[model samples]
Target: MSEINKVKVFRVQGTGPTPVTVKISRIGKALRIKCDCPAGAYMDPCEHWKSLFTGEDQNYLDITDDEIREIQDWLDDSDLDEALQNLLYFEGHEKNMHENLARQKRALRGRVIDILISDPQL
Candidate 1:
């Protein structure tokens, strides 16, 4: 059996008032897994979502199992960011890679702003 066919299950903590537990199970020939999140059922798994299943941090929202499988398929077939972008769209969110990058750049600029604001002569 291929690695994709192997069954993998993960328990993730939720961020709600009551921490939620998520379970992911790998399904077929593709490196797809099934998730127990409400959104997980409709969307593919993302690295963040996969992290949830792999005992990583709980930064991802709940998703469905089939969606996890689809994500796995995309990951296997495409680049990481491409797969992620596709997965993001599946979750009703648009991937703003450029925007995020710009935000990071702006944050870096803040250091310059601080230096300028703190006048040495003042």
Candidate 2:
């Protein structure tokens, strides 16, 4: 017989009054995440947050929790095609920065899936 064990999950929650929060929880054999940003709610990575995490680009933009929520709301209402276009734009922008083409491709695919779930039309 197999015994069930609990897995510990880590998350990166944004700072400031309106911060972007990433909550990672274990679901079955995979990890589930919930984000407070527009792209986050869609489970898609936001360029701003990604930049902060990866240090790929810096815009010096201070994102508040409210702003993150607002962005999530907007994303919830955005069209699928538009969301995909936005994702593709980000992927293209990141192409040159990532040295590993395979990693970049995987990242792009994940982003596309997130976008599709958020907006199936795309």
Candidate 3:
């Protein structure tokens, strides 16, 4: 069996009364992530998207362990995986240098946003 295409859908609890949906899918060699939040509507990778990768979205996520593994696998196969690792590495080593860390975050954030907007499903 082959995992040719992968998809994960999450209904995350947000500020609104109802939860919003964040859809992540693998398209060829690119990733397509979509969220129904304001930031996502503008093609921004909102906290919803980031938290999913960071595992900080557990409280808001209504998914099973198997689904979690699937998402992790999807991320592991994407370029964002390397970017996230770099971001984490910098975060740990640049704590004392707040100014430098801020700059690094901005630069890395731009790359992540660019990746998010690269292959919009719409």
Candidate 4:
């Protein structure tokens, strides 16, 4: 069978005393990215994974630049790429989505959580 199921865990700096776990899983067609921090465990996307995917390296205080670049490159090649791109696009152009703002936000959150809670190939 074609290889598609995969998971990558990153020890991200910031958000707490120790590094946090940021997991990116590709199960079937969904890309479920999760963070173990308080906010993330509740299905909210914390700045830990958000900053990593959003390329906000300067916001980091503990990780090295090389580590940041590695995560960036890895995410760029992973299934999360499309999701990240979609998120970036949505954030940048959502002003045009005027009336659909709340609905879109809810849809994105539910879709992401649903993907994460589903059975995993791993």
Candidate 5:
């Protein structure tokens, strides 16, 4: 069978923290499922995938193409936000160069500290 490369988006509703977005793509007979939750962050198959592929339950609703576009737009906007943040961190005028660099360094250090504090592996 020919593989359809188009991705299908779905929202899984459950009694968990919040609804999770799942994207599935089919290549041949194999299905690649991805989710936005922490479990999916490491590219692990999530509950959303189990339900769809394991035939346990169909807990997800297929989302429209417009909804997918909106999600993509939001992700693009987040990239823009990160770019703006980097500009504030590293591209300031020379007059406040030291201060700006220091501030950015502090922000990064804080992130490291936070991760270390919360991460089980640390």
Candidate 6:
């Protein structure tokens, strides 16, 4: 018998607080990578896994399971109303933010707007 299941988590250092979780499972003689970030949302291998496997200088911070779980739990329980309010309050501040970060924030704001408009419970 060989190691068949493993999990690793890392904090991607960037404009936003991004934590990526990687799960590797073995079946027969092959290993697979699974991640839960936007780049991996489609259930395919993502850049995070690629960087780890390739030993590239991705400049990410290694994190423990507890830290990742704390972030994940917060995301899971996030309140849409509060999130929208915060985004609206800081809407124009993106002018002073980094270009890539501002773009990500804008994209997230747009998605939240769409969700709010379409959600029947709201």
TM-score of each candidate structure, all chains considered together: 0.36, 0.31, 0.61, 0.50, 0.42, 0.37
For residues 9-83, write the lDDT of model 5, one tens digit per residue: 778876577888887664443445578888899976566655442235545666654654544333223423354
lDDT (10s digit) by residue, model 3, range 31-100: 6789998999898767676776666643456777777677777777675678766866666577758888
State the lDDT at 25 in candidate 2. 34
Mind giving the per-residue lDDT tens digits that candidate 2 earns over 1-122? 43222232223444445545554333333333455767776767665444432345433344444544433333332343355457667786787567577788999999989999999677
Query: In model 2, which regions exceed 4 Å deviation?
Result: 1-17, 47-94, 97-122
- lDDT by residue (39-114, candidate 4, tens digit) is 8879886777777666665345455677666556656456667867887788758757775788899889998888
C-alpha RMSD between model 5 and the true structure: 17.1
lDDT of each: 0.52, 0.50, 0.75, 0.70, 0.60, 0.54
lDDT of 1 by residue, 2-55 (tens): 444344344455554543344433334233445555667566553435553244
lDDT of 3: 0.75
Error of 4 at 118 (Å): 66
Every model: Cα RMSD to truth = 8.8, 19.0, 16.1, 17.1, 17.1, 18.3
Poorest stretch of ten by lDDT in candidate 2: 2-11
Candidate no. 6 TM-score? 0.37
Worst 10 residues of 6 by lDDT: 72-81
Ranking by TM-score: 3, 4, 5, 6, 1, 2
CA lDDT, candidate 2, residue 121? 78
Encode model 6's per-residue lDDT on 1-122: one tens digit a residue.
Answer: 55333344455654347666665443333444567777678865455654443344555677654644443333222343355336544643664567778789999999999999999998
Model 2, 75: alpha-carbon shift in Å? 26
The CA lDDT at 51 in model 2 is 46
